[model samples]
Structures are given as C-alpha cells and as structure tokens.
Target: MEPRGVVLVAAGGMDGRGAMSVLYIYPGKMRGNGLDLVARQHLQALSEAGVKVECLARGAVSMPGITCRFLRHTPANALSFLPAAYYYGAQSRFFGAWACRLLDPGRHRLVVAFEGAAGRVFRRARASGVATALICPMGHVGASGSRAELAWPAIGEERLEEEYAAADRILVRSRRAAETFIQRGVREERMVVVPGGVDEEAFHPAQVRTPGPFRLLFCGRLSERKGIRQVVAAWKEAALSPEQAELWLAGSEPNEMKAWLDAACGAGVVRLGFVNDVASVMRQCDAQILLSEAEGMPKSLVEGACSGLATITTSEAGFPVQDGVTGWTVRREDSGGTARVIRQMADDVEAVRRMGASARQEALRHYTWAAFRKAFREGLLPLRQSAD
Candidate 1:
C-alpha cells in the first residue's frame, strides 16, 4: 500500500524526507565519504523505504535510489557576525532564502524544517496548503536567548521563535528537550519526541576489546558543554598509573582548553582529533563517558552501547542507560563520584565486561535505525490518517 502524503525536508544538514515524492534539501556539499555520515545514513534509509528523494548537495552521493540535485552555490561561511550566536542563524536563514527560490510549493503536502533553518521554507510550504513540522533536534532550547545561544549557536532567538510559531508540530528528540521548549512557552501538544538512532550494521559489537590498560573513550567535540574538563579532572583523580588505566580523547580539541589538554596529553593521555573510525574506537575501548550539561540522546552514547561498551555518564546526559545494568550514571559535575565509579571498574574488569554485554543487548532491542524511521514516517501522516 502507498503512503498518504509527499513531504519536503529542508535542513542545513541532511535530515529526513518521506517515501515517494519526498524531496530533501541540504545547504552544503555532500560526499560519499565525509564528516556527515549520519546524514548520508538517513538519506540511504529513506531511499530504501521507497522514497523518491531529490537530494540537493554539492557533490555526488553514490546511493542508487536517490536523485542528486547539485546546488549551483553551496552553503558558505562567507558572512561575519557578532556574539558568535547570530552566525549560524544568519547562515541558516540565507540557506532557506536561496532554497526557497528553487521550491515549487505546489508539489509537497507536508514539510519538515530542521533547527529553525527552514522557517522561510516552512512558511512557503504552509502557504501551499501543506502542514509544517519544526525540529530543533538538539539537547534543549532555553527560555533566554543567551541560553539558546549557548546550546545551539547557529539558531538565534528570532529564528527559533519563528520556527516555534510557524509549525503545526514541533519535533523534539527527548523528554528533557520537550520540557525545555515547554518552559519557553510552547504547548506540550505541539511537541513530539522522536529520538535519534544508530545504524546497527556500522556500530554493532564486532570485536572484543583486547587485554590492556583500563581504556575509556571521550568522543564528540572536546568542549566544556560535553564535560571534557570534568572527565579529565576525574581521570586524574582516579590515580591509576598508565599501565593500569588510560584515557583516549577523540574529536576536535577546543582552542580555549589547549593548555590544559596539552599538559594532560604529556601525562600519557592520547589525543586523537576528529577520529574517522568511531565504531572501531568504541569496540576497542572498555568504556566511554559523556557527562554533558545538556544533551538530547547523543548518538555517540548509542554507538558505544551498540559496540558493547559500558558508558559511564550522568543523568543530565540523558539516554536510558540503566545504572548498574547497562552502564553507570554518576552525579553531575561530581569528579569524586565519577572517579569512584572508574576506580570500581578498574578493580573489577569482569563487571565492566558484563555491563558492556548487557548494554549491547538493551541498545539492540531499543535503539535501531529501523525504529527511528518508523516513528518519523508515522509523523508524516495527516491527523486523520494517523488516527485511522
């Protein structure tokens, strides 16, 4: 049976579009191999679901079912801005402005905008009798402009408000994220929770970690927001020699923390900036940690769980990792608490391994890409069709 409606997805990055007559618009260059593999995975999944996706990217994506539409002008960092918060909002707005020129609103029955980037596109889609869905797809948006600025730099208060007011439904990835939006005055009814998922084929447990030092990984950008400094502090407090325990830091190092990071690196911490093989890193490590101040079900945590590695995290880091079952969640910002947890793991390798196996099972049962796609596709259906 055919699905009810055709949708248009406008994202500054690769987001989602439905099956059959669905068009996906991207603001930047897309390659077969690049940093944005998550976006590529999404595109591939939608195509496999039989969506006729007209993809707007700079380069070629080798997907068999997708139709590539090369934008004459790629999304550029050609503008200057202040407070660093307006830069992304401005760029996203520009992308929508340029993209709207190419859109024929007569075609789509539904439209989805990602991270306030497609407010203009949503407006146009709504004008053509299409329902609009807005999604920030982040940890949280604060009541104050500065808080939103701190959380999502590319989306400013104005653009965020525009998106909030324009759409029929607002898609959030977690309950915490929905709460944040509600606090900002958006009704609970308008918010729909659709968490992100991992591609199991790429991230499933492929190899058992070899016997070595008690290895722990810290992925994602090395920034204060991700609790990099807190992890470093707790690791130092764990008081284990290099032979007994070691920490590996992946992703880009923050410029502001270079001095601290350099000193830590000299003390035997390995720094791998922007690792390409995240799954390999996860599979090889005994554990991982993400003690973020704010988060919306991080993909790294899911990947780690899928790779059969117990993740040491915090409640604020959100994503249902069962404490003492799949993994452990320490007190937020408590270096002592984190250190104690790490110390216990260091002593009992068997317990860590057991938790890792359980983590993989739980993730496999709940956090698959298939589930993400099913939820997203259902959201595309009209209210009547959905109720039916």
Candidate 2:
C-alpha cells in the first residue's frame, strides 16, 4: 500500500519528485560536500521512483518539482533551537517545525530525520501524528576527525544523546554504525543500515588505464583526523621511485594544516585543491588510498571501486571489499604497513589490475544507485505502512 505521506529531514536538501512528496530539511548551506552529494542522490532516486521531494535549506538552492524553501530566521532568536548557543541553534528547529506545519498541514505519514539537529523537528512531527524516522550517517555520533569544522560546544554530547533517544527509527550506513547507535540505547530493530549509493555511469573504469607515473590518489580533506599525516608518512616509507609512482592528494586542506601541507608540497608532494571532476582524476590513478581515522562508508571508496581502482582504506570505511579480494584494508595507524601495500600495488601492475577488476565487479554487483534505492524502499516501506 502507498504511504499516506512521507517526509525526509536531513542536513542537506534534495531536489526531485516522487509518488509521496518527501520534505528534506538541510542544516547548512547547500554545497558540494559529501552530505550534499548523498542527499542529491536520495532525491534523484526518490524522484525516479515517482515520489515528490521538497527541500529546505539556509542558503542557495534549486529543486525541480519539489518545493524549495529558505528559512530566513536566525538560531539565536528562534525558540526551537535547543541549548541555544549555536548561531541557528534555536531558530532552525522552530523554523523547521513551522515549515513542516505550513507544507504538511495534515502532517506527513512518514518523516525521516537525517541529522541530529533535525531530531527535535521529527519529534514535533511525531507528536503531530507523523511517523518519524531519523537518518544518521555512519560515524555521526562518534567523535571523529572530520567533524572538527562542524563541532559545536553548545550542542554538546548530552544533547546528541537526547536527540538519538527521541528518534523513532535511526538510519545508519554500516553495521559498525548501527552497533554504535544500539550501544547508545536505540533498539536494534529500530536501526536500519542503508549505505550510500555510487554513480556507476559517472565513475566506471576506463577501457584503458591512463598513462602516468603509477599514481596513488587520496581524495578527501587534508585533516589530521583523516590520517593525512599517516598517508604521507606511508607514502614516504613506501618510497616508490619518482619515475614509477607519485602520490596525488586532492581536496581542500584545513587552515591549521596549510603550513604543513605547504612544506610537504615543497618537498615534491602533489596536492590538488578541490577539483570539479574527481572521476577523471580517479581514472588516471591506479589506486585510491584512504587512511581515515573513521568513516560512515565514504563515497570515495565506492567511487574508486566503480572506477576499477584498487582501494587501500581502513576497516572503518565499511566497503564490502575484502582484504586481497576487491581491495585492501590497512590498520588505521599503521602507515608503514599501508605504505608497503601501496608500494606492492605500484610495483605489481598485474596485481593492481586484478584487484581493480574485482573492485569494479563488486561495485556493479552491490553499490549501484538502483540497488541502494531498492534497499531503502524495502527498509522503510514497512515502517511507512505501519505509520499509515
């Protein structure tokens, strides 16, 4: 049976139409970040499945067939922003609630909250008779390296816990993440593990490998928590001949780490600031390296797999690639070990090709957008029906 109404609240907005209109509320400005990409994919997939999607954001936005509303209120004056220290702490929640009431007067049958900040709004929606689900990316609750930029002393750990307890259902990206939520007191049955999907068409392997000095690519922010220093040390230890292999670091560098990165660059490390076409760069590289301290299933790993590049990441990445099967999973702090793996892949062209082939096969079989949509529908359909 069709759900009576459906709403999706997240930290990023979506733009598309579906059978049941989905309201997506994002916490920040719509940018080219990983969260934005995931939200876009969800909206696009839902639209393809014939569901209408609406988006709410604080800044610049565009959505087709879905309503795009920008809330103008600041968090300081907004009564709903909890603990009230954040710039938009109170206002975002109040405005979100108001927006929900305005857009969904009768209340949505199903409301999915995507981030911790959206929890209060979801609870309000539930109180108004909307069945709500909370969607949290893997590693969200865990204090990790990537969130340094987003950390808020005002929100605090207790507030995060309160939000988690309030959600009716929690959506996670991996088994590890689900475990984290369960440990936090969310019932096991209330948690759903749905990984982000990959764009196969855009990130597939080239018919032929691009010619270059065996390129080793790392595409993510250069933050200490991301293990950039570990990656650099590993690369240095691996000591691939300049003629044989070169390390390529792509994406923005944190301000605090700029001097360190500059020093590395002066010593011949190649760091390319954010690029428009990551796929093109992935195609040119032989392998993708990610030594993150933690992850909720990074898109880069899947992209690497789709592009037929061997991936060398930590266990936290949560990709299905097994050690020596599809790709390699190195210890988080073992830069020396990771470096050895990189050196081996750089030296053995045949091995790298074989691993790359396996990685692409895995991506095709398990990580496509269609597969993700199917899983998402299956996971949420029962709850949506029950709520109706």
Candidate 3:
C-alpha cells in the first residue's frame, strides 16, 4: 500500500535536514538532544525511501532544511508537563486538527506522535480518519517517575493514561516498554517495539581512541534516576589505583548529584559537563557505564557498542546485550554488584577487549539505521493498510 503521507508530532525538536517530503511538529522550540538526532535520521531514511518530508517546531530556531513554526504560548517543560498540557489544551488540539484538515486530503495518510504530548493532536487526526501512531522513546509512562514529577505533583499519572489510550499504535523502544503499555490499558496488538538505532557510520570503532588507559565513560544526564551517584560510588568501591583506570563523565549534572560529586573527594573521576564531542570521549573510554534506574533503549549503549567499548548497563536499558558476551548487564539499584562487575572487567584487560569486540560486532549486526528503517516500515505497514 502506498503511504499517503506521515506527520510526526514530537515534544522533542525536529532536525530533518534532508527528505523528499517530511513534516515534523515540535511542542516547543527545538533544542539539540537525542530527539533532534533521531529526527534527522528519520528524514534521511524517509528521503532515501523516496518520501517527501518537512519539519516544523512550535518555538524552534530554523535549521537548514526544516521549516520552523512558532506557537505563541510556551510549553511548560518539553521533558515533562508542557507537552501533556498541550495535548489536553483546547487551542493546541484545535490548531493541530485544523492543520491536518488543511493538508491535501488523501495526500497524507498517517500522523505519528513522537512524544506523549503530541497524542491529542494525533488522536484528533485519527478521529478525522488519518492513521495515527505514537512514537515514544521511553514508552508512554516513565518507568521510574522523573525528577520533574517528584518536584511537581501536578504532573499526574492520569494524564499519561489518557495519552496511552488515545493512540492507534504505540511505538516503543523495547519489549519491556511494550509490556508497560499493555499494563497501562493499551491492547497488546496496538503496541509496536521498534528499538532505537545507532548511526554506525558516525558512531563506529574507527572514531574511538586507541592504546590509552582503560577509560571508563558514563554519558547521560547526571541525575538520580540515571544512577550517576551509584556509578560514582561503585567506582570508589572498586578502588582501581590511579594507573589502572579513570572514570570520565560527559553530561550535565543535576543539582542533587552535585553534592555527591563534591563529597566524593576523588580526583580520578573526571566530570566533563555536556560535551558535544561525545564520539571523542567514547573512543577514549575502554568501557561505557550506564546505571539508569529506568530507560527505553538508551542510545548511549548502541553508540558505545558501535564504538567498540565494553558497555556496563542496567536491565532498564533494554538492549539485547548477552551477559558476558556483548557487555555486562547489572541490576539497577545494586551498586555493589555493579561495582564488582566493573572491577572484574577492569582487572582483566583481555576480557575487556573481548567484550568490546563482541559489543562492536553486535551493534554492527543489529543496531544499524538500515535495520531500524526496515523494521519501522514493516511495523507501520499493517496500520497504514488498516487506515485505508
């Protein structure tokens, strides 16, 4: 079946530089993040498939190939409430519906919600007979409640439930997340598991640094849920003397984690806050560590694996890494167990190299963008036909 057209509404900003025809709708101004990269990749894939694509953001600065549209009202927080509020608001809902209505009838066949907040618009589109899908990075609900939710009680579970029920299809990053949606009232068949993909060309072993000290790297927001504190504590417990290995953290630290870093009293841990050149850091590191309490399929794991780094991640990461083969999978809350694993890997240079090699091989075999594009097309095909 030929696709009419697809509209992607994401809380995250759009970065579709090249596409035959693509339209990306952001909840607020676009910022550089995982979503932006994914948007760019999506456009590239769709363009290669001979689809036309255009991109726009509510409050985004214009990029090279994507068009930017501004929404008068600002969203609360792109990560949390703002998108939810937009999804529920009458004005945003009406605006989206009207926009979709104006799109040449039969020209566009599907509307995809990139994040939860985009649900209302997509729901309205579906109500208007357009096929709808929600592309969630971490799933419909946050597995572990976010810091924003904890700090502000206003972001309730009820709103999330509403978003879950509204979508025609829920695109998730892992089987675990698909299960989460099933529990949240979405039918099993309505959910699709399209694991996140890595740009092998950009994040490959060739870019990594070689012949260096066993550098341990941790990338992601240094927040409690990300388990940055646990990782730091584990490193301390492992007690690798200065010459053995060093911990390199490349991400923005949350305020709560700052005190932990100040109290740690160690020079071995290097905190490089929010570095854009992540590939460089990945290359320098011998292993990548992610102790997140909850995740969808983390991009870091894919990138780390692609870059030939032995990854130490939590079960929440949801990547199909074989235990003792591709990388080490540790329990989310068990710092002691995690530390033991890291120490063991660090102690054996040959074992670390072997794991890194396997990790790279696994990434190349399964996590490439080409694989993801094929899966995405297959997953959406049935729904597209049903919409017809």
Candidate 4:
C-alpha cells in the first residue's frame, strides 16, 4: 500500500487521495456543492491517515503535499434546466476522458473514476496493466427512465456502461444499488457496497430546541421525486393548519413546483436557496422528511438524523430508519398517509424530540463520518495491495 500509486479521474467530487502516491484529476470549478464537500472530507481523511495525494483540480485549493493543477475553465450554467444534462454531462465527460492523459498508469497501481465521466481513461489505464475502478454512485441507468432523482443525462448511459465493463471493480454506496447492477447483468463480485456517512461533529443535536412553530425540514431539490410536492399536498390534505406545522424548503427551487407549492404551503413555507450552513438550519427544525421515490442513500437524511432531527423517510431511500424507533418510514407517497403521520407528530412534540435524540445517539455510534471513512478505506484498499 505504501508504494502503490493511484490516479483519480473525477467529473464530480470525492477526491480519492489516500495513503498512497495518488494523483487526482477533477473539475477545477467544483466547490460548495454536495459532491465537492464529500470529496473534501474524504481527501482530508486520506491525508490525515498519511496518504500522499497529488490533485489536479480546476480551481485553486491549497493543501500540504497535494499538488493542485487547473483545467483552465469549463462552462456550466446551473440555472438552465432544459440543457443542464447535456452541458454537465459533456463537461464531465471531457474533463474525465482527457484528464487522465496527464496521468501515466504505468507509474500508478490503480486508476479510479466516476462512471461515464471516465471516457477512455479506464481503457488506457487497463492497457497499461493498471487496476481500474469506477465509482458507481447511482443505480442502473436503464432503471432511471427520466426519474427526477437520478440527476444524470440519458446520453451518458452508453459511456457509463462501457466504463463499468472496463473497470476491475465498481463501487456502490448501498446494497440496493449493488442489487440494481447485479440484476442488470453486472457480476456480484465486481461490486462493493460502502454506505454513506454523516459528519457527526458538524451535524450534532441543537443545544436546545428553539421556541417557535412546529417545523418540518425538507432539504434537497423541491421536486416530485424528493416528495416535496407530496409533502405540501399532505400538509394540506392532513388539514394541519400553518399553526400546526411549518415546512422549510432548502435547496434549489424548481420552476415546476412553484405553482403547486403556492396552493399547498402558502404562508407556511420558508425557502432558503443554496444554504451554506445546513447544520444551523437543522438545529432550528423539529423533524426531517425525505420520502424520496428512489435514491442512493440521501445525504440530507443522514445529516438531519445526525443533527437529532426525527427522520420521516421512505424505505426506497435505502437507510435503516426504524418504523417508530429511530424514525418513521412512510410506505406510500399519497398525501393522506403523510398527513396522518404529520398530524400525529405535531400533536406529540415530545415524541418527536425523543425520536430525534435517538436518531443522533444511534448515528454517532453507527452512521457517523468516522464510521463511513473506516468502511470507505476498507472497501477502497485492494486485498492484493494490502498484503504488500
């Protein structure tokens, strides 16, 4: 492990510079995004653990012993929704496919990268007799079918499949994602399940619940897939007036949801777009809901749970939230079921607090960032390399 060298071709984040002679190839413009934050955390962990990392990011970031390089520039318009997939997909593909040419796999033990973004980088890595890996963060593309939650372009599917085929191993965040791949003909031995982790220190319980209206926090894109529209509908459907519950929508405001939101939330909704300090917001709320139709372990749920917010999530989210213990799980997206649960929680504030407390306490021991990093390192470290 000490002598091995690794090269990373990243379209998004998760800088894989660990205890090895590693080189990172990533978009320079990536910062302040969820994926960027994750990359920073893991990169820091790898450094603290004594891995020698060299980074080729688009922007300027200062780190000790980590060499930072630039990609000149890449045009990305976060505001344009219709062309977002094409723009970002092409950007990542260009960044990933060409980034690795600067990296010589003959000098590295491994070359790892995101699916679709890797372009021909993995093929080149394989040609050099290097072990190639792809971080398959999502489920299969065939299953996505224009689902709002998948968040990638259909055009990138062919490239992703090719990269998967080229990689020696493909990494996934949950057993659910692995199952999706296996069902799609990917070998079980080729997949690794490394669950998501929360930064417990950053998302701890509030010192005291602030005196305010009963609040339910909803963080993530306010789309149908995230169950935002459903939550709003249920809020009205449950007949719980604004005095009973307040919904805070934090994240980008999708144009498609604004019309329905006005009718459902009215004065009861609080919108905070692109919040820099999510932990503080979590402290102000009573509970969190992420009744997503599908997901690869929503980080917002984990962050909320770590912050002692009672989680009202769906089983499709892939987290083990107990029915009434750690948190409540809604089986259906129908407004009535959600409303009923909301009404019950609103009536019993103490129960919500208790469940929230349990969420953080259990997470600190089991789902914290420390836990994730340990699992991540174990899964990332190759057995053959470890024996060295």
Candidate 5:
C-alpha cells in the first residue's frame, strides 16, 4: 500500500522530459529552521537544477516540480526521553523502514539520506542496485574526539561505519570532515566536500561599525559540546575591561550550564538569549568565536565570515578559518591560546577589520548557496549517469 500525503506536485520531467527521479529522505520535520533549513535548501537546489526529487520527510514543503511525501508522525514524539543521538538514530531507522516499503526502483534511481538516520534505507537501496548517497552534516563519529564521550554511546561507531560502507557517495561539509571518513577507511573518491553556504545578502557587513565596546559574539547553543566553557574562560583570561571589550552569548542557555554561565555573566559575558536576528547581531559585533570540539562546516562561522566579522575557531570546528586572514584558529580547549587571540583582537581593531574584510570576500567567493548548488549539481552528475 502507498503511504498517505504523497503529493505529486507536477507533471513535468527532469528538464521537461522523462528522467529517473532521486529519492531524498530526511528523517525529521522540514520546518525551515536549523537542520531543517539546510535540508530545504538541498531540495530546492536539486529541484532548481532540473532534477526530479521525491522527498520523504516527517513534514513536507510546498515546491513546484517535486514530490513530497510525509508520515503523519514519528516515534520520536514518544521517545523524547532518550538521548539525542539515540532518539535520532531510532527515528532514522524507523523512517527508513517505512520509506523502504514504498521504494520503487523503477521510479527512483538514487537515494540520498542525511547522517545515520537512513542507514537501513542505504543498505536496502544498494541491494536493489540503486545508488545511494549519504550526507553527513557533522564529522564522522570515529573522529569525534571528546564529543564521543557523549555521542558515541547512543550512536555507536559501528552504525555509521555500516552506513558509510553501503553508501555509493558520501557528501561531507568540509575537507576536515572528509579526512575523518578517510581515516575511518572510506575511499577518497566516494567523498564530495560541500561546505555549508551562507546568505551573502542577508549577512553582509555593516557599512559603518556600530558604536560600542569591542564586542565578540558567540552565537550558538551554550553547551559543553560547543566549548562554551572554554570560550568564557578565554574571555576572562584576556582581562579586557567590560567597558573595553564584552563577550556576547546569543543562544539558549541549557539548564546544566546555568551555574557556570551565571559566574561568567559577572565577568563581562552578556547573555542575549536566543537571538532571532543573528545577522543583525553580527553586524553590531567586531568578531565571532566558536571553539567547538567537533562539527561539520559550522553555519555560524560561515555566516559570520559572510557578515564581515572576523571569526575565531578551532580547526575541529570544520570552518577554514585562515589564521590571521579571516580570523584566528585556536586549538580546541586551549583557553590560553584563545585568550591570546582575544587579547590581540581587542588591542588591534584595525587588523581585525582587515581580517573581517578578507573573510567576507572569501565567503562571497566560496561559501554562498550559489556555490553549494553548483558543486552539488556537479557531484550528482556521475550518479545520474550511472542511474541512466
């Protein structure tokens, strides 16, 4: 039996003629925010490039020339108590199983899935001789150093390895992310590095710098995984007076980190909890910092660069922060190194401006969605050929 809510949005073919369609599975809602926003862009990119896509999601998007199918609900609602990794893994596998029952090899040539959610679907597609692509939005689990302490248990390392093995192509967000897969024995040829994109117009530099202290922004979840503690420690160690420099944290403060964050608040950290206009915040700030221990290409850093703010990051953050050009790339958890970088940025505003200019140029050249769409279309060429 066919699943409900399967809308065949248009009668047109790929390029207005018959062509094998691609199956895109996202094991969650398409809510147009965060990961959902990224997924939405991927769908639009493929559709705009004249590829017919049949997307299976928990919720659907309204787009011309595409098929959108959605399940009424997912097990995730009941399993909310589980750890995030475990919850998502279970959801992915469940969605994969349901999608498999509806799989039509004659209609769909390839299957594209995100992360560990659709490993089951990858294996099934391979068995049916349909090529499969896996989009790993974050670094490989095996390479997730300190993050493994929390992530590895629910999302076991072996699960991702199996997914990687079954996938004909693996799309990663950075060269750093690709290296992690290579280290885990995935072939280099199978990898396609698609750095996450930013909206260049929406995040452009302020024509005039806002008048204030030398403000540095940290604009994501204030969690241990984000290395927020290290960022605060570094800011305190820099010893810049509150009037001279201020550290602004612009994301949700998790309950677990409240005590630490409260202490940091007294030492020049200003909580701008859950900002909706991050670009506007970026425009007002002198620099952006993210010292995450592991990531795919971080969207905040990319957007920061696009917004013409110098970025301070760790290499593991998966953003290609050209040391001293775009911003500083400090070692993860190295509070002393981060402190030195912070002090330098505070003392030398002119150099920071130069870095911000360079960063924006780099982002416009390489990190816009236009660049991502072109690269994505090219990456699909070989798969399309094989499917034909």
Candidate 6:
C-alpha cells in the first residue's frame, strides 16, 4: 500500500519540510455503506499508502495511524420536519466553512475533499496554492432522475459547479458517473474514475443458502426512488407464496413508505430493517436485486456480487453485470423483466447458483478494497510531487 511520494508526520510537525501531507474532509459520519464508507475507504487507502493524513468528519472513526477530528454531532433527525435536501445542504455548508479554517497550505500538500462540502475548501486551498482533489462519490449533480436516486441530494448544482471549477482533480466512482460529468462540460482529463470496492473477506462468496424458502434480498433505504414499489410490483407478478419464496429488505424504513411497505410485509415481504452485518443476510439469500433509476456505483451491488448472489440491477445503477453470466441487468421500467428473472431464479436454482459463482469471481478480480486502494493511490498521489 505504500505508493511512494507521501510521508506521515507527527502533530504540529508541519515545518513545511515534509514529503506530502493531506487534509481530508468528508463532512459526514464514516460508517454507512453510502458516502461514509467511501470516505473511510479513502482514508484507509491514504494511510496504507504512507501518506500523512488528517481527517475532519462528523463522527469519530479510530484508525491506528491517522489523525481524526470529529465535528460537533448534528443528527439528521434534528431537522426531520424539513425536506431532506435542506438539512444535507446546510450540514455540508457548515462543515465546509469549518474545514476551510483548518487548511494551512504550508502544512498540507493536498486537500482531499468530498463534493457538496468542498467548495470553500477548494477555494481556500487554491488561494493558498495547495493542491485539491474533489471526490464526487455520487457523480454529476445535474444527472436526470429524482434527487433521492443517489445517497445524498444534489446540494445545488451551482454550488457543486463552484467546487468543480476549483478542484485540481475530480474522482468519480464509475465510468457512467464520469460520462455524466463529461456530458456536463467537465474535462475528461481532470476527472478520474475510481470505482467503489467490496470487503472480500467480510462479503465473501456464500457456500450455501440457508435451508428453506428461496429468498430475494434488497439492501438499501426503502424509498420510491430506489424502485421499491417496482420491486413489490415484480414480486406480485411472480406471485410466490411464503412457502415458495420471500423478499427480504434490509434498510431503514422511512415514514413516507411505511404504510405501503407494511401492507407488503403480510404478503411474504420480510423487512429486516437496518441491518449492520449485511453479509449475514446476503449469505442466507439466494439472489439480490436493485433497480435504481440512477447511481454512482452502489456498494450493495458489489457486496452482493462478492457475496455470491446474482444481481438484478439496471445499467443506470452503474455495476457492469455480465448479463446472463454474472447477473441480469434489467431496465429501470421493466418490472416484467425483473419478474421473469425472479421466476427464473426460483424455478432454476442451479442456474442462479452458477450466476452467483460467476459474480463472486468477477467481484474478487475487480472490486476488492485492495484494488480500490491501488486505484486511489495511483490516480491521486502523483499530485503530491506537484504540490511539493
């Protein structure tokens, strides 16, 4: 993991006499499968690469060699009554302003930051002549679809544009994400497609599904934009009974969709609700499905694939499924196709098992955390020399 060019130093050791030191700002907790996980992975990559790192985040994550500064906690439910977008935008702006004050060009060679909260940091870093890399985990803000399609809100495309204009490099999660940015006038050379990764050990291939009903798993927030309603529609079309099959959903159930999902629960839809160890749940299931309308490369898809579950996803969801080999890539609007795939898995268990095996092999080869670390180190650390 030591990618050459950066050095880890002690506290207050910034005599402006180091190899390359970085100030990483995420502005969110370092725990979920969303951007939080992305931030944690980047920090891990930077640390393993022997890069000097200082992290600013909403929640504290203790890593042996990195300096982590936890910001004052502001729970999202604090503003539960308002629209989700406002709370996220306000949080990003607040964190960005706070993080901007901590930037000392003499100490930090490069500032690695996430979008929505990097505008001020980028501006400050540029003014101070420090290098800047913006991590756009969710990709282009202007991409068409519901705002909730990605993990976070767009955070105002204009604000993101300001950040983009100042960033020396923009790191995205997938080729599709990079394409969206290119379509929106972002120079291809300035953007790096650093796709997401899976923890191979934690999400390893399942040896066998738990005995009983053939289960279909959906892991994410229960929302309309996530195509939950469509999932239910497809399940209805398949018309499997509890004895024959079951649909397992693992995520927070929002109030808006609670009533609808509650009704579905009676008809073989089991809500495991907010699971922490997703691997355990995936191990018990026969297959996974996510028909998202838009995404930057969902970790769930990679995790599922790594867990040896054939996926039913959309091209827009950004995981390159090998069509009948690894999984089925369905249209966002094609519930019938999804239903057919579901029926296929139930009717042909051996075929589903073969698909899952292929998926795990593909994931292990391309989407492991080690691979992500390599890509991150290679794509961004060279800026260290320029900064030096």
lDDT computed for candidate 3 = 0.66
Q: What CA RMSD would you report for each candidate? A: 6.3, 6.2, 6.6, 5.8, 2.9, 5.5
Ten consecutive residues with minimal summed lDDT in candidate 3?
1-10
Clash total of candidate 1: 2
lDDT of 6 by residue, 253-338 (tens): 89889988877756788889999989998999888988887778878889999999988988878788888898888887787888
Residue-wise C-alpha lDDT for candidate 3, range 7-108, written one tens digit per residue:
333222444332222334444334555776565555455545544434444434423333434454533334344444334343334334444544432545
Q: Kindly indicate the candidate among 2 and 3 with the higher lDDT.
A: 2
For each candidate, what TM-score against the reference? 0.81, 0.81, 0.79, 0.83, 0.92, 0.86
Measured on C-alpha atoms, candidate 4 has an lDDT of 0.69
lDDT of 1 by residue, 142-174 (tens): 534364544443666776677788877777667
lDDT score at residue 322, model 3, on the 0-100 scale:
84
* Candidate 2 lDDT: 0.68
* Candidate 1 clashes between residue pairs 3 or more apart in a chain or in different chains: 20-51, 89-154
Best model number under lDDT: 5
The per-candidate count of clashes, in order, stands at: 2, 10, 12, 5, 0, 0
Candidate 4 clashing pairs, residues 3+ apart or interchain: 14-39, 18-51, 19-51, 28-58, 28-59
TM-score of 2: 0.81
How would you encode candidate 4's per-residue C-alpha lDDT over 330-355 as one tens digit per residue? 86566788888888888888899999
In candidate 6, which residue ranges exceed 4 Å CA deviation?
Answer: 1-20, 31-34, 59-65, 73-84, 144-154, 264-266
- Least lDDT summed over 10 consecutive residues: which range in candidate 1? 1-10
Candidate with the greatest TM-score versus the true structure: 5
| lDDT tens per residue, model 5, 184-241 | 7788999998888888989999999889889999989998778898888888889999
